[model samples]
Target: MQTAQLHMTMTGASEPRTARVWLHRYATLSAFCTLVLICAGALVTSNDAGLSIPDWPLSYGRLVPPLIGGIRYEWTHRLIAGTVGCLTLGLAVWLQFADPRRWMRRLGITAVGLVVAQATLGGLTVLFFQPPWVSTAHACLAQAFFCVMVSMAVFTTPEWGSRAGIRFSGARTTEKLAMTVVAAVFLQLLVGAGYRHKGLGMNWHLAGAVIVTGFVFWTVVRALRYNATESGVAPAAIALGACLLGQLFLGGGSLGAKLYYADAPQPMPIFVYVTTVHVALGALTLASAVVLALLLFRSEAQR
Candidate 1:
């Protein structure tokens, strides 16, 4: 009888563990799909397809439209966005039932809310013929939604819950600096988005880039120097550093491509590719800084 009871206890315990693992994996998948959706959105903007469909919640008065010219890019972006919305909704529902943490459940709900807002903004961008401010907000909100999805993915990982008590000196300072870096990166993204939509000038975006790069380096160097051995801190810091470097190169390439294609009747393929990649990498840089900041804060809390 004792053996049977023990077996049942083991089975019951294993189920929740299995569920957590699946939940983590699902969250990670949601984050990845969000990134892909960002890329698709970037592609649409780069290809000058924002108003190709001339309709929202439907393409050309139908669920699917004839995918031709810029219509292809715009329609594909919409389809991918729809898929992301479904994934986010599923993730939120799963977290509500399966996760024990109240904050995480709340975060899932927030993710759902952000996705809804993002979709609405996307529709508005089309309906209003891509007004600069509206379009820039749409771009910025996508980055925010991406950050939320990434945070969920990181929080759900087993490592996040079971992290060792790895304390480090100056953790508070590191956390503050990391938070600064995140803010800088986000602001730079805002400027870049504004520049892309022509609401702001290239000079403002360039100035923001320089400021952000300095902040990123400062945070990264501090984390690596002091918290190099911390479980999550070092890796996230390294990623942020790498992403910043890549973004710089992509930024230069994008500038050159834009100038080269300035006289072209339409956006050249090279221009589209470079600018889209720059935008995608910018999203990645912001996400990396966010992860690093969160991990730093978690470490400080554990201390």
Candidate 2:
């Protein structure tokens, strides 16, 4: 028993069960809430409803407004954003108390700061009547915040903590591939954000799609090739591949729906759903890439 305790302490894996439970729960909740917030933001963009309220931190000079017309989408988005901010704040505080790793506590602090900045950018988007650049920045920052929450969730997993000292062979190649995938995904997301807001980078976004897809597939292949030796890599890589495929399908559907609406000049319900979902899936893809990269390159004890 003493030997086990010593070994666990040396491995930095001596988390109490209750603390781990709370931290894991908070992390999962934060990640889910962040994803929902991203979806709401996408809906606002797809519906062209960012300025529907015409107010910052309030809707029509009131706390609660009737959920009618464009106000429904815009106000709902604000509400969700506020909820996500609170959840992230609570998560950060919880980590400060429950998590043993200094880096994780710091990550929580950074996430709190990001949520505040993201909210401020969101307000700026409304105050400035949704300037293309400001709105694009808001979108980009939201993705960053989402990535942070996802990382928190990953860090709280038992598997992550237990694998601290199990260094995999071929880690260099895995690191390079993971880093490339993450970089390409983020660059593609930035181009997508710009294109979504102002249509200024449509060509660039299209070009980036090709590059992101190639890197994503290559990363998956690399992980799978080493799966016999590194079990965790294959699962994460496969999940990333699934997200990439979903994004590609949504992208195609969005394009088709847009072209159809362009000629028909009619309301296309599917178009909004497709485009918004595409945006959400893009964020998911970025988060997955980041998680895979961190898992491949960094140990839990290192964090």
Candidate 3:
């Protein structure tokens, strides 16, 4: 036995079965809650609701705001963010003080780090007026950290983690291809973020989702060409394809609005709504890539 495992065995008294069950339950709930928090923030951007409050850590100079009218979206997003922050903070405490596995303890620490990093990114977004790189990185990190949280949950749960034997020898060729598609999709997401922040390319952004369309098409093509039919990577490929189609319509709608305003008596409408949806979905593309990467990593670990 490994030294750590040996030590654990030697010194350990039995943990109450019920206690372990509760811990597993808590981790499972925490993971799902964290995922919901992630989607809430995504919608904040999707609806151009970030600046609705026009302040950080407070909405309209208050910690809590009336949730009537459009403030509802912004305020609700904030409330959910606060709740998520607290839940993760609680999860970290539980892991540190209660969880016995050495690796899980480290993962809890990593989760804490991710929370801190995410908060800092949020602050930078506010202070810097939502710079594209910072915002996109902030957004991408949330999704990445969500996956990490999911992994932690997976490791902690009894029915999930203990039985899934590691496979270190598997379809090496397919695994590498899946990994490659994920990397390309991640790059495409970053590029799409850059495009969203482009001040001069409003029209092109609307018309130019063709770029990502081709990328997703390529990703799907490759996934079909390589991965096992039963693997999770195929769904990610399908998601990329779906998101790309949505991008085309959202991009065109945004650009169409811009051109329409250019001809109207009123000022040009803000492109943020369309832009942010594209931006948020772009994050989704990155996340789908991340999941595919996880599948590849799983395959490699098993081998």
Task: For each of the candidates, give the backbone clash count.
Answer: 0, 0, 6
Clashing pairs in 3: 166-302, 167-302, 167-303, 168-302, 168-303, 169-303
- Alpha-carbon deviation at 206 in model 2, angstroms: 0.8
lDDT string for model 3 (220-245, tens) is 67666666463566776687677767
Candidate order, lDDT descending: 1, 2, 3
Worst 10 residues of 1 by lDDT: 1-10
Itemize residue pairs with steric clashes in candidate 2. none
What is the per-residue lDDT of model 1 for residues 1-303, given as tens digits with 9 covering 90 to 100? 434433443455665667777989999999999999999999999998899988888998999899899999999999999999999999999988776666888999999999999999999999999999999999999999999999999888866654423354565777778888888899999999999999999999999889998889988999999988776789899999999999999999999998988899998999999889899999999999999988877777676
Cα lDDT computed for each candidate against the true fold: 0.87, 0.82, 0.62
Q: In model 3, where is the ten-residue run with the lowest total lDDT?
A: 199-208
C-alpha RMSD of each candidate structure in angstroms: 4.0, 3.7, 5.6
- Tell me the deviation in Å of residue 184 in model 3: 2.9
Candidate 1 vs candidate 2, TM-score winner: 1
Ranking by TM-score: 1, 2, 3
Q: RMSD to the native, candidate 3?
A: 5.6
